[model samples]
Target chain A: ELKVEQNPLFLSMQEGKNYTIYCNYSTTSARLYWYRQDPGKSLESLFVLLSNGAVKQEGRLMASLDTKARLSTLHITAAVHDLSATYFCAVDQGRSGSRLTFGEGTQLTVNP
Target chain B: GAGVSQTPSNKVTEKGKYVELRCDPISGHTALYWYRQSLGQGPEFLIYFQGTGAADDSGLPNDRFFAVRPEGSVSTLKIQRTERGDSAVYLCASSLNAANTGELFFGEGSRLTVL
Candidate 1:
Protein backbone atom coordinates (compact mmCIF):
# COMPACT_ATOMS: atom_id res chain seq x y z
CA GLU A 1 0.00 0.00 0.00
CA LEU A 2 1.07 3.55 -0.62
CA LYS A 3 1.43 5.65 2.52
CA VAL A 4 1.65 9.42 2.72
CA GLU A 5 2.92 11.28 5.77
CA GLN A 6 2.83 14.98 6.37
CA ASN A 7 4.82 16.90 8.97
CA PRO A 8 3.78 19.67 11.36
CA LEU A 9 0.28 18.21 11.49
CA PHE A 10 -0.82 21.28 13.36
CA LEU A 11 0.85 24.59 12.64
CA SER A 12 0.20 27.87 14.39
CA MET A 13 2.06 30.77 12.89
CA GLN A 14 1.82 34.53 12.91
CA GLU A 15 0.38 36.22 9.88
CA GLY A 16 3.05 37.21 7.35
CA LYS A 17 5.27 34.37 8.46
CA ASN A 18 6.46 31.72 6.06
CA TYR A 19 6.23 27.99 6.47
CA THR A 20 6.47 24.74 4.55
CA ILE A 21 4.31 21.63 4.88
CA TYR A 22 6.02 18.51 3.66
CA CYS A 23 4.35 15.39 2.24
CA ASN A 24 6.31 12.19 1.91
CA TYR A 25 4.93 9.17 0.10
CA SER A 26 6.10 5.57 0.22
CA THR A 27 5.54 4.66 -3.44
CA THR A 28 6.24 5.95 -6.90
CA SER A 29 3.53 8.14 -8.40
CA ALA A 30 3.23 10.24 -11.49
CA ARG A 31 0.98 12.92 -10.04
CA LEU A 32 0.65 14.73 -6.71
CA TYR A 33 -2.08 17.12 -5.67
CA TRP A 34 -2.57 19.69 -2.92
CA TYR A 35 -5.97 20.52 -1.50
CA ARG A 36 -7.33 22.90 1.13
CA GLN A 37 -10.36 22.39 3.32
CA ASP A 38 -12.04 24.79 5.68
CA PRO A 39 -14.00 24.05 8.86
CA GLY A 40 -17.09 22.51 7.24
CA LYS A 41 -16.38 22.63 3.55
CA SER A 42 -15.09 20.03 1.17
CA LEU A 43 -11.56 20.14 -0.18
CA GLU A 44 -10.61 22.62 -2.86
CA SER A 45 -7.91 21.78 -5.37
CA LEU A 46 -4.73 23.78 -4.85
CA PHE A 47 -2.24 22.35 -7.30
CA VAL A 48 -1.39 19.30 -9.36
CA LEU A 49 2.28 18.50 -9.74
CA LEU A 50 2.80 16.04 -12.56
CA SER A 51 6.52 15.44 -13.04
CA ASN A 52 9.65 15.47 -10.98
CA GLY A 53 10.61 19.01 -10.02
CA ALA A 54 7.16 20.18 -11.04
CA VAL A 55 6.23 23.37 -9.18
CA LYS A 56 3.04 25.36 -9.15
CA GLN A 57 2.14 28.51 -7.25
CA GLU A 58 -1.15 30.23 -6.59
CA GLY A 59 -1.24 33.39 -4.54
CA ARG A 60 0.69 32.70 -1.36
CA LEU A 61 0.80 28.96 -1.79
CA MET A 62 3.32 26.99 -3.82
CA ALA A 63 3.51 23.24 -4.36
CA SER A 64 6.24 21.07 -5.76
CA LEU A 65 6.72 17.42 -6.54
CA ASP A 66 9.89 15.37 -6.58
CA THR A 67 8.94 11.98 -7.96
CA LYS A 68 12.41 10.56 -7.56
CA ALA A 69 12.31 11.12 -3.83
CA ARG A 70 8.62 10.26 -3.67
CA LEU A 71 7.95 13.54 -1.89
CA SER A 72 5.93 16.67 -2.39
CA THR A 73 5.84 20.01 -0.58
CA LEU A 74 3.33 22.77 -0.06
CA HIS A 75 5.03 26.03 0.86
CA ILE A 76 3.20 28.99 2.30
CA THR A 77 4.76 32.33 1.56
CA ALA A 78 3.74 35.17 3.90
CA ALA A 79 0.63 33.53 5.23
CA VAL A 80 -2.57 35.39 5.97
CA HIS A 81 -5.59 34.74 8.16
CA ASP A 82 -7.53 33.44 5.21
CA LEU A 83 -4.86 30.84 4.66
CA SER A 84 -5.76 29.06 7.88
CA ALA A 85 -7.14 25.71 6.83
CA THR A 86 -6.36 22.03 6.61
CA TYR A 87 -3.98 21.24 3.77
CA PHE A 88 -3.82 17.79 2.22
CA CYS A 89 -1.53 16.11 -0.26
CA ALA A 90 -2.83 13.28 -2.43
CA VAL A 91 -0.84 11.01 -4.70
CA ASP A 92 -2.24 9.38 -7.78
CA GLN A 93 -1.53 5.67 -7.91
CA GLY A 94 -0.64 6.26 -11.58
CA ARG A 95 -3.45 3.98 -12.62
CA SER A 96 -6.09 4.52 -15.27
CA GLY A 97 -8.67 6.17 -13.01
CA SER A 98 -6.34 8.30 -10.94
CA ARG A 99 -7.10 6.67 -7.63
CA LEU A 100 -5.61 8.81 -4.84
CA THR A 101 -4.03 8.11 -1.50
CA PHE A 102 -4.08 11.12 0.75
CA GLY A 103 -2.03 12.33 3.68
CA GLU A 104 -3.30 13.06 7.18
CA GLY A 105 -3.40 16.77 6.43
CA THR A 106 -1.85 19.80 8.15
CA GLN A 107 -4.12 22.09 10.11
CA LEU A 108 -2.63 25.55 9.81
CA THR A 109 -3.75 28.47 11.97
CA VAL A 110 -2.57 31.91 11.09
CA ASN A 111 -2.91 34.42 13.88
CA PRO A 112 -2.62 38.13 13.52
CA GLY B 1 -20.10 26.56 -15.12
CA ALA B 2 -21.27 25.26 -11.79
CA GLY B 3 -18.97 23.01 -9.83
CA VAL B 4 -19.76 19.56 -8.58
CA SER B 5 -22.88 19.60 -6.40
CA GLN B 6 -24.04 17.19 -3.69
CA THR B 7 -27.47 16.98 -2.17
CA PRO B 8 -28.71 16.68 1.41
CA SER B 9 -25.79 18.75 2.65
CA ASN B 10 -26.42 17.31 6.09
CA LYS B 11 -27.90 13.96 7.11
CA VAL B 12 -28.61 12.69 10.59
CA THR B 13 -29.76 9.12 10.84
CA GLU B 14 -30.10 6.39 13.41
CA LYS B 15 -27.87 3.36 13.44
CA GLY B 16 -28.91 0.56 11.06
CA LYS B 17 -30.89 2.99 8.97
CA TYR B 18 -30.42 3.35 5.26
CA VAL B 19 -29.28 6.52 3.57
CA GLU B 20 -28.52 7.66 0.07
CA LEU B 21 -26.24 10.56 -0.83
CA ARG B 22 -26.37 12.15 -4.22
CA CYS B 23 -23.78 13.89 -6.37
CA ASP B 24 -24.07 15.96 -9.51
CA PRO B 25 -20.84 16.35 -11.37
CA ILE B 26 -19.88 19.47 -13.24
CA SER B 27 -21.24 19.69 -16.75
CA GLY B 28 -19.01 17.92 -19.27
CA HIS B 29 -16.98 16.23 -16.55
CA THR B 30 -16.54 12.58 -17.45
CA ALA B 31 -15.09 11.26 -14.24
CA LEU B 32 -16.63 11.28 -10.73
CA TYR B 33 -15.43 10.06 -7.37
CA TRP B 34 -16.76 9.40 -3.86
CA TYR B 35 -14.74 9.87 -0.72
CA ARG B 36 -15.34 9.70 3.01
CA GLN B 37 -13.58 11.91 5.51
CA SER B 38 -13.54 11.44 9.27
CA LEU B 39 -12.87 14.17 11.77
CA GLY B 40 -9.37 15.59 11.27
CA GLN B 41 -8.57 12.97 8.67
CA GLY B 42 -7.94 13.18 4.96
CA PRO B 43 -10.55 12.11 2.47
CA GLU B 44 -10.60 8.36 1.88
CA PHE B 45 -11.35 7.26 -1.61
CA LEU B 46 -14.45 5.10 -1.88
CA ILE B 47 -15.03 4.72 -5.58
CA TYR B 48 -14.19 6.18 -8.96
CA PHE B 49 -16.36 6.30 -12.08
CA GLN B 50 -15.37 6.92 -15.64
CA GLY B 51 -18.34 8.04 -17.68
CA THR B 52 -21.14 5.77 -16.44
CA GLY B 53 -19.04 2.84 -15.40
CA ALA B 54 -17.31 2.31 -12.10
CA ALA B 55 -13.66 1.89 -12.86
CA ASP B 56 -12.70 1.28 -9.28
CA ASP B 57 -14.59 0.39 -6.12
CA SER B 58 -11.82 -1.29 -4.22
CA GLY B 59 -11.54 1.54 -1.74
CA LEU B 60 -15.02 0.95 -0.42
CA PRO B 61 -14.71 -0.38 3.10
CA ASN B 62 -17.35 -3.08 2.77
CA ASP B 63 -20.49 -4.30 1.14
CA ARG B 64 -22.62 -1.78 3.00
CA PHE B 65 -21.07 0.97 0.91
CA PHE B 66 -22.17 1.11 -2.71
CA ALA B 67 -22.30 3.79 -5.39
CA VAL B 68 -23.70 4.07 -8.89
CA ARG B 69 -23.41 6.53 -11.73
CA PRO B 70 -25.83 5.42 -14.40
CA GLU B 71 -25.78 8.34 -16.79
CA GLY B 72 -22.25 9.51 -16.27
CA SER B 73 -23.56 12.77 -14.84
CA VAL B 74 -25.24 11.98 -11.54
CA SER B 75 -24.13 9.52 -8.91
CA THR B 76 -25.64 8.17 -5.72
CA LEU B 77 -23.96 6.50 -2.78
CA LYS B 78 -26.09 4.08 -0.81
CA ILE B 79 -25.29 2.97 2.69
CA GLN B 80 -27.06 0.04 4.29
CA ARG B 81 -27.38 -0.69 8.01
CA THR B 82 -25.35 2.36 8.79
CA GLU B 83 -23.06 2.19 11.77
CA ARG B 84 -21.87 4.96 14.05
CA GLY B 85 -18.45 4.39 12.61
CA ASP B 86 -19.86 5.45 9.25
CA SER B 87 -20.67 8.92 10.46
CA ALA B 88 -18.50 11.28 8.51
CA VAL B 89 -18.55 13.78 5.70
CA TYR B 90 -19.10 12.12 2.32
CA LEU B 91 -17.42 14.07 -0.41
CA CYS B 92 -18.05 14.05 -4.17
CA ALA B 93 -15.61 15.23 -6.77
CA SER B 94 -15.47 15.44 -10.56
CA SER B 95 -12.80 15.97 -13.12
CA LEU B 96 -12.63 16.45 -16.85
CA ASN B 97 -11.45 12.86 -17.20
CA ALA B 98 -9.19 10.33 -15.60
CA ALA B 99 -6.23 12.01 -17.23
CA ASN B 100 -3.36 11.94 -14.75
CA THR B 101 -3.06 15.69 -14.39
CA GLY B 102 -6.73 16.69 -14.21
CA GLU B 103 -7.51 18.42 -10.95
CA LEU B 104 -10.69 17.38 -9.18
CA PHE B 105 -13.45 19.83 -8.35
CA PHE B 106 -15.26 18.93 -5.17
CA GLY B 107 -18.74 19.47 -3.90
CA GLU B 108 -19.54 20.93 -0.51
CA GLY B 109 -20.03 17.36 0.81
CA SER B 110 -22.84 15.58 2.61
CA ARG B 111 -22.22 15.36 6.32
CA LEU B 112 -23.63 12.10 7.71
CA THR B 113 -24.24 11.83 11.42
CA VAL B 114 -25.31 8.50 12.82
CA LEU B 115 -26.69 8.69 16.30
Candidate 2:
Protein backbone atom coordinates (compact mmCIF):
# COMPACT_ATOMS: atom_id res chain seq x y z
CA GLU A 1 0.00 0.00 0.00
CA LEU A 2 1.13 3.52 -0.70
CA LYS A 3 1.06 5.86 2.25
CA VAL A 4 1.33 9.63 2.24
CA GLU A 5 2.15 11.71 5.28
CA GLN A 6 1.98 15.45 5.69
CA ASN A 7 3.59 17.56 8.38
CA PRO A 8 2.07 20.13 10.72
CA LEU A 9 -1.49 19.28 9.71
CA PHE A 10 -2.78 22.50 11.22
CA LEU A 11 -0.89 25.68 10.46
CA SER A 12 -1.76 29.19 11.50
CA MET A 13 0.45 31.82 9.95
CA GLN A 14 0.19 35.57 9.81
CA GLU A 15 -0.08 37.34 6.50
CA GLY A 16 3.25 37.94 4.76
CA LYS A 17 4.87 34.94 6.44
CA ASN A 18 6.52 32.06 4.60
CA TYR A 19 5.79 28.40 5.25
CA THR A 20 6.30 25.04 3.61
CA ILE A 21 4.02 22.02 3.68
CA TYR A 22 5.77 18.70 3.21
CA CYS A 23 4.36 15.57 1.60
CA ASN A 24 6.20 12.30 2.02
CA TYR A 25 5.17 9.16 0.21
CA SER A 26 6.10 5.57 0.97
CA THR A 27 6.49 4.28 -2.57
CA THR A 28 8.03 5.45 -5.79
CA SER A 29 5.80 7.53 -8.05
CA ALA A 30 5.99 9.23 -11.36
CA ARG A 31 4.00 12.35 -10.58
CA LEU A 32 2.73 14.43 -7.69
CA TYR A 33 -0.08 16.96 -7.52
CA TRP A 34 -0.93 19.81 -5.19
CA TYR A 35 -4.53 20.81 -4.61
CA ARG A 36 -6.30 23.37 -2.46
CA GLN A 37 -9.80 23.20 -1.08
CA ASP A 38 -11.91 25.61 0.87
CA PRO A 39 -14.56 24.52 3.30
CA GLY A 40 -17.46 22.86 1.46
CA LYS A 41 -15.72 23.17 -1.89
CA SER A 42 -14.01 20.69 -4.16
CA LEU A 43 -10.30 20.59 -4.79
CA GLU A 44 -8.58 23.13 -7.03
CA SER A 45 -5.42 22.01 -8.77
CA LEU A 46 -2.40 24.05 -7.76
CA PHE A 47 0.55 22.35 -9.43
CA VAL A 48 1.50 19.16 -11.22
CA LEU A 49 5.08 18.13 -10.59
CA LEU A 50 5.96 15.40 -13.08
CA SER A 51 9.66 14.89 -12.79
CA ASN A 52 12.48 14.97 -10.29
CA GLY A 53 13.59 18.49 -9.44
CA ALA A 54 10.49 19.86 -11.15
CA VAL A 55 9.23 23.08 -9.61
CA LYS A 56 6.25 25.22 -10.47
CA GLN A 57 5.17 28.50 -8.97
CA GLU A 58 2.08 30.66 -9.20
CA GLY A 59 1.57 33.88 -7.29
CA ARG A 60 2.58 33.35 -3.68
CA LEU A 61 2.61 29.54 -3.88
CA MET A 62 5.26 27.22 -5.25
CA ALA A 63 5.56 23.43 -5.43
CA SER A 64 8.52 21.16 -6.00
CA LEU A 65 9.04 17.43 -6.37
CA ASP A 66 11.98 15.17 -5.52
CA THR A 67 11.17 11.74 -6.89
CA LYS A 68 14.26 10.05 -5.51
CA ALA A 69 13.30 10.98 -1.99
CA ARG A 70 9.66 10.34 -2.72
CA LEU A 71 8.79 13.75 -1.40
CA SER A 72 7.06 16.92 -2.55
CA THR A 73 6.73 20.32 -0.97
CA LEU A 74 4.26 23.19 -1.27
CA HIS A 75 5.84 26.45 -0.22
CA ILE A 76 3.90 29.54 0.55
CA THR A 77 5.71 32.82 0.15
CA ALA A 78 4.22 35.82 1.90
CA ALA A 79 0.82 34.31 2.52
CA VAL A 80 -2.38 36.34 2.37
CA HIS A 81 -5.67 35.99 4.20
CA ASP A 82 -7.43 34.81 1.08
CA LEU A 83 -4.91 31.96 0.83
CA SER A 84 -6.30 30.25 3.87
CA ALA A 85 -7.41 26.77 2.94
CA THR A 86 -6.52 23.10 3.19
CA TYR A 87 -3.74 21.92 0.91
CA PHE A 88 -3.39 18.34 -0.22
CA CYS A 89 -0.64 16.48 -2.02
CA ALA A 90 -1.45 13.39 -4.05
CA VAL A 91 0.85 10.84 -5.59
CA ASP A 92 0.34 8.79 -8.74
CA GLN A 93 2.29 5.61 -8.08
CA GLY A 94 3.54 5.20 -11.64
CA ARG A 95 0.79 2.78 -12.47
CA SER A 96 -1.69 2.88 -15.32
CA GLY A 97 -4.45 2.54 -12.72
CA SER A 98 -4.76 6.31 -12.31
CA ARG A 99 -5.45 5.97 -8.61
CA LEU A 100 -4.18 8.79 -6.43
CA THR A 101 -3.10 8.33 -2.82
CA PHE A 102 -3.49 11.60 -0.99
CA GLY A 103 -1.86 13.01 2.11
CA GLU A 104 -3.91 13.86 5.18
CA GLY A 105 -3.76 17.53 4.15
CA THR A 106 -2.48 20.73 5.70
CA GLN A 107 -5.07 23.19 6.91
CA LEU A 108 -3.62 26.66 6.62
CA THR A 109 -5.13 29.67 8.32
CA VAL A 110 -3.64 32.97 7.30
CA ASN A 111 -4.36 35.71 9.76
CA PRO A 112 -4.44 39.32 8.63
CA GLY B 1 -20.79 22.75 -18.54
CA ALA B 2 -17.29 24.19 -18.49
CA GLY B 3 -16.05 21.67 -15.88
CA VAL B 4 -17.07 18.46 -14.23
CA SER B 5 -20.56 18.54 -12.70
CA GLN B 6 -22.16 16.40 -10.01
CA THR B 7 -25.84 16.18 -9.20
CA PRO B 8 -27.65 16.63 -5.90
CA SER B 9 -25.19 19.05 -4.36
CA ASN B 10 -26.47 17.87 -0.98
CA LYS B 11 -28.34 14.75 0.10
CA VAL B 12 -29.90 13.85 3.41
CA THR B 13 -31.15 10.31 3.85
CA GLU B 14 -31.94 7.83 6.58
CA LYS B 15 -29.93 4.72 7.12
CA GLY B 16 -30.97 1.69 5.00
CA LYS B 17 -32.20 3.85 2.13
CA TYR B 18 -30.65 3.59 -1.29
CA VAL B 19 -29.20 6.63 -3.00
CA GLU B 20 -27.78 7.41 -6.41
CA LEU B 21 -25.23 10.09 -7.25
CA ARG B 22 -24.53 11.33 -10.73
CA CYS B 23 -21.49 12.74 -12.44
CA ASP B 24 -20.96 14.34 -15.83
CA PRO B 25 -17.37 14.64 -16.86
CA ILE B 26 -15.94 17.42 -18.93
CA SER B 27 -16.32 17.12 -22.66
CA GLY B 28 -13.62 14.98 -24.31
CA HIS B 29 -12.40 13.56 -21.03
CA THR B 30 -11.73 9.84 -21.30
CA ALA B 31 -11.24 9.10 -17.63
CA LEU B 32 -13.54 9.64 -14.68
CA TYR B 33 -12.87 9.01 -11.01
CA TRP B 34 -15.00 8.79 -7.87
CA TYR B 35 -13.76 9.65 -4.41
CA ARG B 36 -15.12 9.98 -0.88
CA GLN B 37 -14.05 12.60 1.62
CA SER B 38 -14.86 12.55 5.29
CA LEU B 39 -14.73 15.70 7.32
CA GLY B 40 -11.12 16.81 7.92
CA GLN B 41 -9.67 14.14 5.67
CA GLY B 42 -8.43 14.10 2.13
CA PRO B 43 -10.38 12.44 -0.65
CA GLU B 44 -10.07 8.68 -0.95
CA PHE B 45 -10.29 7.05 -4.36
CA LEU B 46 -13.33 4.83 -4.79
CA ILE B 47 -13.27 3.93 -8.45
CA TYR B 48 -11.90 4.89 -11.82
CA PHE B 49 -13.53 4.58 -15.22
CA GLN B 50 -11.76 4.57 -18.52
CA GLY B 51 -14.21 5.28 -21.25
CA THR B 52 -17.28 3.13 -20.71
CA GLY B 53 -15.56 0.53 -18.56
CA ALA B 54 -14.22 0.60 -15.06
CA ALA B 55 -10.47 0.28 -15.23
CA ASP B 56 -10.13 0.00 -11.48
CA ASP B 57 -12.55 -0.44 -8.62
CA SER B 58 -10.20 -1.79 -5.99
CA GLY B 59 -10.67 1.16 -3.71
CA LEU B 60 -14.39 0.47 -3.37
CA PRO B 61 -15.02 -0.52 0.25
CA ASN B 62 -17.55 -3.23 -0.54
CA ASP B 63 -20.38 -4.43 -2.74
CA ARG B 64 -22.63 -1.78 -1.26
CA PHE B 65 -20.84 0.76 -3.45
CA PHE B 66 -21.04 0.35 -7.18
CA ALA B 67 -20.54 2.73 -10.10
CA VAL B 68 -21.22 2.68 -13.80
CA ARG B 69 -20.20 4.75 -16.77
CA PRO B 70 -22.44 3.34 -19.42
CA GLU B 71 -22.15 6.02 -22.12
CA GLY B 72 -18.49 6.84 -21.62
CA SER B 73 -19.44 10.31 -20.47
CA VAL B 74 -21.94 10.28 -17.66
CA SER B 75 -21.52 8.10 -14.61
CA THR B 76 -23.61 7.17 -11.60
CA LEU B 77 -22.66 5.81 -8.20
CA LYS B 78 -25.22 3.74 -6.36
CA ILE B 79 -25.20 2.95 -2.70
CA GLN B 80 -27.26 0.07 -1.38
CA ARG B 81 -28.47 0.38 2.18
CA THR B 82 -26.52 3.31 3.35
CA GLU B 83 -25.10 3.58 6.87
CA ARG B 84 -24.14 6.53 9.00
CA GLY B 85 -20.51 5.76 8.30
CA ASP B 86 -21.22 6.21 4.60
CA SER B 87 -22.05 9.84 5.06
CA ALA B 88 -19.43 11.97 3.39
CA VAL B 89 -18.79 14.23 0.44
CA TYR B 90 -18.72 12.33 -2.83
CA LEU B 91 -16.42 13.92 -5.33
CA CYS B 92 -16.22 13.23 -9.06
CA ALA B 93 -13.24 14.09 -11.20
CA SER B 94 -12.30 13.73 -14.84
CA SER B 95 -9.08 13.71 -16.76
CA LEU B 96 -8.16 13.93 -20.39
CA ASN B 97 -6.96 10.34 -20.41
CA ALA B 98 -6.22 7.40 -18.17
CA ALA B 99 -2.51 8.14 -18.13
CA ASN B 100 -0.67 9.16 -15.02
CA THR B 101 0.28 12.45 -16.60
CA GLY B 102 -3.29 13.63 -16.98
CA GLU B 103 -4.48 16.22 -14.52
CA LEU B 104 -7.85 15.81 -12.85
CA PHE B 105 -10.65 18.35 -12.83
CA PHE B 106 -13.01 18.01 -9.88
CA GLY B 107 -16.65 18.77 -9.31
CA GLU B 108 -18.05 20.68 -6.37
CA GLY B 109 -19.04 17.33 -4.81
CA SER B 110 -22.26 15.94 -3.34
CA ARG B 111 -22.43 16.10 0.42
CA LEU B 112 -24.34 13.05 1.66
CA THR B 113 -25.74 12.91 5.14
CA VAL B 114 -27.20 9.70 6.55
CA LEU B 115 -29.22 10.09 9.67
Best by DockQ: 1
lDDT of 2 by residue, A1-112 (tens): 8899999799999999999999999887568999999998999999988899999999999999999998899999999999999999998876785688889999999999
Evaluate fnat for each of the predicted models and list the values in order. Answer: 0.80, 0.70
In model 1, which runs have C-alpha deviations exceeding 4 angstroms? none
The local lDDT score (0 to 100) that residue B54 gets in candidate 1 is 93
| Tens-digit lDDT string for candidate 1 (A14-100) | 999999999999986568899999999888888988889999899999999989998888999999999999999998877888788
Model 2 CA deviation exceeding 4 Å by range: none
Worst 10 residues of 2 chain B by lDDT: B96-105
State candidate 1's DockQ.
0.83
